[model samples]
Target: MKITVKELRLILTVDNLDELIHFYRDTVGLETSKEWHEETGNGIILDAGRASLELIDSKHAARIDQIEVGERVSGPVRLALRVTERIPEATETLIEWGATSVAPPTTAPWSDVARVQAPDGMQITLFATSTLEDK
Candidate 1:
């Protein structure tokens, strides 16, 4: 039988949850769908617009790393976010918000992309396309 999936949520247990929340929600502009600051724990769910799971083999992953970052710097999981435009500006903004720049914006076969390492060490790829048709 085929099981249907509803939504995908990438849950990250971070040490600096507030900092990450600011980086993702405030700086990156993801809408906060829900948040909790009870005695159990503090957590916030930011709406990432849309989500999809991308699987890549080691060879292809390395190739992408080389093209974007000029080195193999990402781990098994990487976050690729599609932006409306201005990848360079967004990348710089992310860097100023405490994310480390893995690479500046570069033109790729698919879109203009930039890589940044989040404060929690998650490698994020920011790609810009004019519209969904362009994507």
Candidate 2:
């Protein structure tokens, strides 16, 4: 048997839903496609552009952590966001929006990456595919 998947939505049960929504939607610039507020619950769906699943082993994850953060900092589930702005600018913007900077912008073999811890304690890695010099 095979299963077909159309869209992937990562639902986060957060304590401060409003703040997280603001961070991802306003600070990160994801367009809000849908939102609901009711007795049952309140939620918003933000369009994150194209999404892809990347599976990596523990060793590889640790290597990536080391390269981006200079240490093993990320847990099993880390959110990697591909941003349009340069890494430094993006990182600074996130920090100003209440994210804690885990590491400075570092140049990796594949891209320029920076790590920040969200208010909900989620480690978010912001990366740009274009070279740092280009941005």
Candidate 3:
């Protein structure tokens, strides 16, 4: 038997729903498709444009951190997003929106990447396909 999955959503169970929503929707510029609230919990779905599901062991995840962000992220999971341009500006914007600047925009093997930590301690990598010099 086979099962078909329709769509994938990255659900972040956050301590402060409003702040997380603002960070992703306003700072990161993802469109908010829907939101819900209950007495016990709340959730928001932001449009990530395109998504890929990756499964890896802890060692591989650490290696990806070393390769992309130049350091090993503390957690078992990391979130990455691809942006068109202005990665430096985007990183700064997120910082202004209350995220911590983990690393400045730098050229990685794949693209120009910037690492930032959300208010809830989620490490996010923002990247663009073109080099920073070109952008």
Candidate 4:
């Protein structure tokens, strides 16, 4: 069988976990449904829609693993979200929400598109493919 969705639990290796949390939580507007912590660690799990994106606290910088058949989360690929209408407004707000744009929002002959670098180094693309709408 083939796969359809991606769920990830990220081990957040950062100098400051609270900053990271604010970025993904308030900036990205992800809902924190569950929270777990120990003496030296903490984590917040997002409802994450169809799939989950979990953020964990780590003191040192190391690579994150992704979910495989036998394992969970080998790593994260740049997550892309598809949206309808108010794309320009949404993207603009995203910048205000603390996402640094890798490429500023622009409209092309084919579509309107924008690129941004999330706090977690995730590359996101926003596109308005009006041609394909209402299909």
lDDT of each: 0.89, 0.90, 0.80, 0.57
Better of 2 and 4 by lDDT: 2
Candidate 3: segments with Cα more than 4 A from true spot: 130-135
* Span of 10 residues, lowest total lDDT, candidate 4: 60-69
Best by TM-score: 1
Provide TM-scores for the models: 0.92, 0.91, 0.83, 0.56
Give the per-residue lDDT digits (tens) of candidate 1, residues 1-135: 998988899998899998898899998899999999999889998998767788899999999999999999899989999876599888989999999998989998878999999999999999976345535
Candidate 3: 10-residue stretch with minimal lDDT: 126-135
Count steric clashes of candidate 2.
0
Residue 17 alpha-carbon offset, candidate 2, angstroms: 0.8
Task: List RMSD in Å for every model shown.
Answer: 1.9, 3.4, 4.2, 10.8
**Residue range 1-135, candidate 4, lDDT tens digits:** 998665655454666667667876775567898888899778777654543343554311122111111123223445544446455676777777677766656654445666666666766656666443555
Model 3 lDDT tens row, 70-108: 777658677877786689988888889998988778887
Candidate 2's C-alpha runs over 4 A off are 130-135
- What TM-score does candidate 4 reach? 0.56
Candidate 2 positional error at 134, Å: 17
How many collisions per candidate?
0, 0, 0, 8
Better of 2 and 4 by TM-score: 2
Error of 4 at 49 (Å): 0.8
